[model samples]
Target: MIETDKNQILLNMMTDYAKNNPDTIFCYTNAAILYETPRWEELPLEIHTVQSNKKIKNRTAITHIRPYFKKSKYKGFNVITLVDLLLELAVNDTEISAISSISHHLYKNEISVETILNYCQSQKQKSGVAKLRHLVSFASRLDESPFETKVRLKLYVAGVIIPVQQHQVICQNKKKYRVDFLFEFKGRKIILEADGLIKYSSNVNERANERQRESDLIREGYEIMRVMNHDFENGRFAQILENYGIPKRRYYGKKIVKKHY
Candidate 1:
């Protein structure tokens, strides 16, 4: 198991022990915690209950037995499987949040497209199965961050040509630079960067390295567009893409409510 904080350590130990018992199954966010999946939210203190034949008296854990439960082992530990965990998340969370969490696993190569698709296919007439199918179709293994996945999905939904994610280009000096998004339009190479404040401002060396990397890419005929989290939050990304010749396919027609005569 990966080294984590004290609380997480305690939670993991509890779940690990729970796996040994036959009556209870660790699941949902708790399953995710045990599996060490990348998540957008902080780890909750309460354990998520998947299945139990008897009442669990632990107050640190939340129990929900509504949706059906299944037990499986991952890496020799008995916990809820990834497919079931994803289905639960899809039913409970927003579409984007579900996609983002799944994307993190895909990006890390911890999960595969075929594996998810196969699992989704096995569950017929299940709630959230259709939505999971659609969401999984948009899942890209190349996304390095949640922001990158969001931007890529937006571009895809808007009918714009999807840029290559994490494209690596070798500079003249034999150094390779991997860009977040790379688009080739009308013979111009454009690079889109999702600039997070923590990544760029955490250290002077990091900032300097980024500057040098940008300068090298620019010298090699690459046009760089750096976008922060606020740009997407404020809905400025579409305009930014439009400025660079990406066509918008989504049309927002003016609302026309029917009037009573």
Candidate 2:
């Protein structure tokens, strides 16, 4: 078989994969993440394409030639380029044309902003979507984590702009504890700690660790709010914020669709 024929065989595989897992976020930088993205796995899928490193107009295009394939604008309306499809999968705003252009690399298939949005809405309704919604809820409370990526998701929903993570703090003895979230408002240091100590062995050890951490923080004259895993999971995060003296903001009491087993 010729190389062209081999390439055709591969593209067909990718098309089949996409049809089955339409919501997976595909990107050049994160091939593994894309492949393992929810609902893509456990369904048995594969991607078929020609492997080439041709730089067209100073941009590297993953080139392929398949007769039956999805077409898009970025690939000149015949068949969608990998980049074009990636951009379509990454679509963000339906109302703003300017923002949609960011994903224009996948726009070649002539995928309209509306179509991208409809696909997104449908993707959000898939079986695991509820679990993902819970995950998004979990992620919103912090900006960064060695704990979990929950922080970024939490802030996004709460409309709380996240402070830089791992900001160092020195206690009176000069010992340091890197804080999870910190915000400076009205010259006060609002320190938020995602209490992930339960994963540590022994309830005794966990309590001791938290006590030491809190003592060290308090000694530094910083008011700290420690949030348990359950608070975020149960929609009690806003109350946790209030207990930390966040002054009852609007998003503090927002209700989320939480799934309970």
Candidate 3:
């Protein structure tokens, strides 16, 4: 029953915030009051003053002073921009300059606008860019995209020097296209594209464009290796290893999980 209450609280926060600000994105952290009990809700209103541990913070008054409270059917939290949240929080009494300053400060620390929005809607009072940075670090570890994360992890684990992502590729025609990952050795370029086949297919016009792009890339002598979601997931690492000519032990055929700290 206690767990159910927390879920209700979180749901309320998320639904209220979303309806009040339809343009704003809602994330779990935005409705994080449900993570702890009412007794632990009061953890110094200011984010800087708030303790890192959940069991230590007291955040009861958070529900009372929620910035958005028109309705009470919060389905879940979402991702939104900092600028939007600031506007929503302030409502008609918008503080433009102050919010811009805060947004600028957060962006400087590599905190995206989405991170700032989540922090603002959270229980912590006086939340700022600094605390937003901390939240971003915590959230990255909890990213939902498992396949992309694991591929990067597998490359790192096998001691392979993976190239930087979104690197630009210049073709013979002087046109450039950025790729997911690029590894340049001597004159040969090994391109690895992490293909998320959600909105793409071979029968569509987009596929035609993709074919042209690949043709142009191949014409430029790029040794491309398109790694799809299935490759890492369906136990096909051996095929990749052989294609890349990276000699592997018999253990390479087995599933490899990254044991990150």
Candidate 4:
């Protein structure tokens, strides 16, 4: 709910509160923010905290009264352990949301899949342990954004061949380029780009730079497919992949019914 600027302000307020109240520990999303976990979005309405003593009555914050397995200090603030934050997210958020959050932090090297698995193993009887256990195997540290994770998950669920994320390729000109997603088909190297309009179209120079980069990649004999946010919203990504001859891994459940072009 909080925009970028507002989110920072809210976090600062929560940090100040944590510093003043030694008996309270920031947990859940609050702690995730303090830990600098990537792609972890906090609710703007309430600051999440865990009370170590008497509960505080506050409208802007939600207090959790529970025994945390571990605690740590980050930026001079008492915060819940990273493992606890992951488990909290797993239980509180949706499956994909939880997976994406964990994957982002993993990609940032703030946590490890093994650590999460170990925690899940120790808490097998917990509320979200089963779901977390199931999703952890699919989480990748290579995914750079929640959007990319969503795209990858959709492709996987539809039985499409999994592609490499943040793939690096050396161009003929001796310059290296990193692609969002890369696949190989019929001996052709294909690059799939997930483009966020705001990020790419912020200014004229940025747009031109991206175009030039794509041109260079194409010149290097790689087939490039640029997919926008709307494409996914309109179910166009599947058609795009199918047109490129990306073979399906296996057929189950409702098949990806191809539309006539």
Candidate 5:
């Protein structure tokens, strides 16, 4: 829920605008909230009618579909401006970590860091430019999921060198596995695994398969570590890293404590 009164007022304000202006195409944050990333139900948005055929919305909800919620960047491709999206994210009273997660999706699928940074360069005087820039710094296309992105941000704060995402390693049986994170410290191969439940919740056998996979990696001279959602949230994984004797650039107590920590 969007707990801010200002955001509530904005949502009502935008909804009113959308109601009054039928056939309106909400742009930027407005469009983004209505379409792809609806973090809050009540977000202040500026609803505008781009074209009669583009989109139409009312007080009840948005209508006419524009998936991806972006302006066209290529021939017949629907794309949102990277800067616009990130800037809106920064101004929405959102936590930096949440904003980083959102930015990760945008970076992974829609835009490149160079492109977004170049665009940000032009928005120097914008209201949320500073926060937007910071959030973008944590954005990574390599993260396969939002949990990975969250882990990555914590790692950054802990001052650990970011790991290589989805790193492929060859095992003793001549099999190859794409690990979640990989770091080389003190000339040792350390693998950090983000153990999200969806990876194995569907079947009991998936868990067994995972253990076997880890066993294989260990047999081939790789030091392995695993973290679940709770470990990342509470920062307990940092202690595990210390216990394993991984070299860190900094000593952060209960901090990150992953290649992505």
Candidate 6:
């Protein structure tokens, strides 16, 4: 789990940057957070300005607004809109899955996919336009988490049949449980859950209830596979997938994206 201090850390960074560069606009994740609380991971501060003299120092990214964007003339310290941030993510070659998750959050709430697409389409000379379109191709409002998106990408890359996400299952006892992902293969019912640190606590009763819930699903013949958030590290994540007999496959996407986190 991210510490509450992360919000303060981001604020401090923005405050320090805005102090010296008054004309510069806090864009990217900084702008996104100004509009709404963060949904995924925290990122470094990004700023944009019409001035070309201000060079980006360590830990901060800088973009210069060209004449076309300058004509629009965004006002205030947070001049970049969500659409601008989306375009910046595209131009910056952000990791594909992270981009998808961010796109999901923005489009599902305050923006439309078409509005983003239309913006991209109109920006013929924009650096990240094509890249943004590729990233958005994988985006949907159904996104739940960055971890889930990573799981989906891993499944896609490994040539495995992607499990049904947010699947509903009814036990014989008349209780209904919503699962993260469900996979059915060769008469076997598999329930895959990705658990973050937020799921675990020191409370004994909570753990007891979790065990009981699993027992109920087990009694109904549904096999449970719980994946901790950290399990995605090292080779452990790949091993878990192979253990489930998901066949390995080659990746087909053209973009070469490295994770920002």
**Which has the better lDDT: candidate 3, or candidate 5?**
5
- Which residue ranges in model 6 land beyond 4 Å of their true spot? 1-10, 13-77, 103-108, 203-205, 248-261
Model 3 residue 92 lDDT score: 18
Report the C-alpha displacement of residue 174, candidate 2, in angstroms.
Answer: 1.7
lDDT of predicted model 2: 0.44
lDDT at 173, model 3: 90
All candidates in order of lDDT, best leading: 4, 1, 6, 5, 3, 2
Error of 5 at 197 (Å): 3.8
For candidate 1, which ten residues in a row score worst on lDDT?
A: 252-261
Between which residue pairs do clashes occur in model 5? 70-79, 70-80, 71-79, 155-261, 238-257, 258-261
lDDT per residue, candidate 2, 57-162, as tens digits? 4322232223334533222213454333433322321211212222221223423434444444566644443333332222222232223344434554566644
Cα lDDT, all candidates: 0.63, 0.44, 0.45, 0.64, 0.57, 0.59
**Per-residue accuracy of model 1 over 1-261 as CA lDDT, tens digit each:** 443474466556655655565444444323443444434234333234343334445512223221222434322344455676666656555556567657866876757878888887898678877677677766777877666776776666556776888899999999998999888978899998877544455688988898899899999999998777677666687778878886444563322111220
Angstrom error at residue 251, model 3? 19
Model 5, 138-177: lDDT tens digits are 6667776656766666666766766788889877688889
Candidate 3 stretches greater than 4 Å from native: 1-147, 199-203, 246-261
TM-score of 3: 0.44
The global Cα lDDT (0 to 1) of model 5 is 0.57
Model 5 CA deviation exceeding 4 Å by range: 1-82, 93-99, 233-235, 250-261
Query: How many pairs of residues collide in each model?
Result: 0, 25, 15, 0, 6, 2
Q: Give the TM-score of each candidate.
A: 0.68, 0.39, 0.44, 0.68, 0.61, 0.67
Q: TM-score-based ranking, best first?
A: 4, 1, 6, 5, 3, 2
Which structure is stronger by TM-score: 1 or 4?
4
Clashing pairs in 6: 91-128, 158-249
lDDT of 4 by residue, 40-71 (tens): 34443333433333444541222321232243
